[model samples]
Target: MRSPVLGAAALFAVVVLSLATASHGALQYGFYKGKCGTKDVETIIQGVVRQRFFSDTKIVAALLRMQFHDCFVRGCDASILLDGPSTEKTALPNFSVFGYDLIDRAKAAVEAACPGVVSCADIIIAATRDAVALAGGLKYQVQLGRRDGMISQASLVNLPAPTITVPQSIQTFRAKGLSTSDMVLLLGGHTVGITRCSVIKDRLYNFRGTGKPDPTLNPNFLQLLRSFACPKIGGDNNMVFLDDPSSSLKVDNSFYKQLLQNKGVLQIDQALALDPATKPIVQQLAANPTQFLTQFNQAMVKLGAVQVLTGTQGQIRKNCRRTN
Candidate 1:
């Protein structure tokens, strides 16, 4: 028979282990089944997205990008939804990002239905899945159970810049626990968004301070972009499609096709086709839209899983814009 002292010590160890696991709970697909009155959170979110932003492709694109930006900076904790004079939204890289109002609207709907149960973080993940599906992209599953973070600092927003080289982009994504292939696949998210002229002005007129356009960009495409995208030096806020003109509103492989043809709009985008390490993936994605979408959906799932705060580690903020 075991000693009474040994039995008590073993019991203490088991309790401690259980507490640790609960405090770091793993995420699941149906995280809020019984806790809320709904077994289908995806359908509920899809209804809201379709009713409000139906066929409004820009808003759909914004919603998708919102989740990407949120995951990149702070592990998809909904820190991007917070507002302040010095929050992540005020950061230079995120200054022009839209869709906070949409996120707030989605959160309000979720709160009304299941007050104090669903998190703003999980709402973002669900909303993004619905948005992409509504945009004619492949539907994929998103694991939930994320918790809202209490902190959002502009100083901590460190997204990759538009002008970064392929090697630099790889390093940036790798620092976030993503691989080079993941970097290429996640970038396909740009397929449905717009790019501001300010982001490409240097490449258009002053590549490396030479006072000349970037030699890598196709000359004919350069003339076309100059004709409309930036007629003047200070058209900083003017915007253009990031993908081929025909499919800017559709999430497809055309962005890679443009790069292969030397029509890529951003320096970082063109660098993918120009570098040996990433060129093959870019070429493969260009020729295989189905494969691109498949890998993109997979990469996004991985993106959402980064450094997440789960279990009892964080709070479910009643207001997404402020910590509860």
Candidate 2:
């Protein structure tokens, strides 16, 4: 009864529809099986962090702090952002309009795209990585389908290593199941940001005193540092590099190279360079920027794998900055 041409066209349409359905189904199943979990988490977190933080240096600094603390204890748990004792208490405000705004935006987008599918914890983790990418860091695909976490423990909030001693920092990371290689890689996040005097005053003044200072710092840079951070007054900390200024924003091995030259900012940054075990990896990362980017992407994927609540477990908060 049907014409041959019409029949063929109908068959083609059916085939196309079938393929699309199959693809969508595969994506859904893959997500449930934890295929794209890392990528989804990183994208969400990075997007939110970028939207929330106004200052690039502050955003990068907070991200580095988050990575250091998260990977230091159990994994990248987004716990470092919480306020409590045992935390570093960096100059960045915990609950700011900037922070919450971006988070809320991310949540809203995710909810619209895949309602009640992804978790806040996953979102936070993904958003941070995305922020790094936005800042010219390397890009890698991550997985998705993580759920939100209902439990927000006070203990988890205050678990960052406040002081920056090499031994203590190493101990902190080791406790978190991170190796020295991971520590060096994670610390590379300092490539793009500034440190406040309040955060490292003790390191600059108490650790080295006025005259000697950290021998790694450039003398001219040190003079600028004293003017900006040393007076103990509240002001912007001078920009420190994980890499050369030209490629500082890029997530690469230059950070390790900087460390090799004693150009690291914090004690933790310098210690990685001197440690024989970590020095090789640092040099490797410096030499092969692509390798560092690959590692960074993989680490981000791992970081996004923390506990998450999904599939009707947690409500989509209208405001990510505040608990609903």
lDDT by residue (tens digit), candidate 2, 1-324: 443223333454464355323321112213523433434434444555665554554565455545444433333333333334433233233321124345456767666655655545555556666667766676444444443332334344444333456666667666655555556666677676445465556555555555456665656655655675466445445444445677665555676777777767666777767766566666667787766765665455544443333455555443343344
RMSD for each of the candidates: 10.4, 12.7
lDDT of 1: 0.80
lDDT of 1 at 138: 87
lDDT of each: 0.80, 0.52
- TM-score of candidate 2 versus the correct structure, residues matched by position: 0.67
Residue 149 local lDDT, model 2: 31
Badly placed stretches (over 4 Å) of model 1 are: 1-25
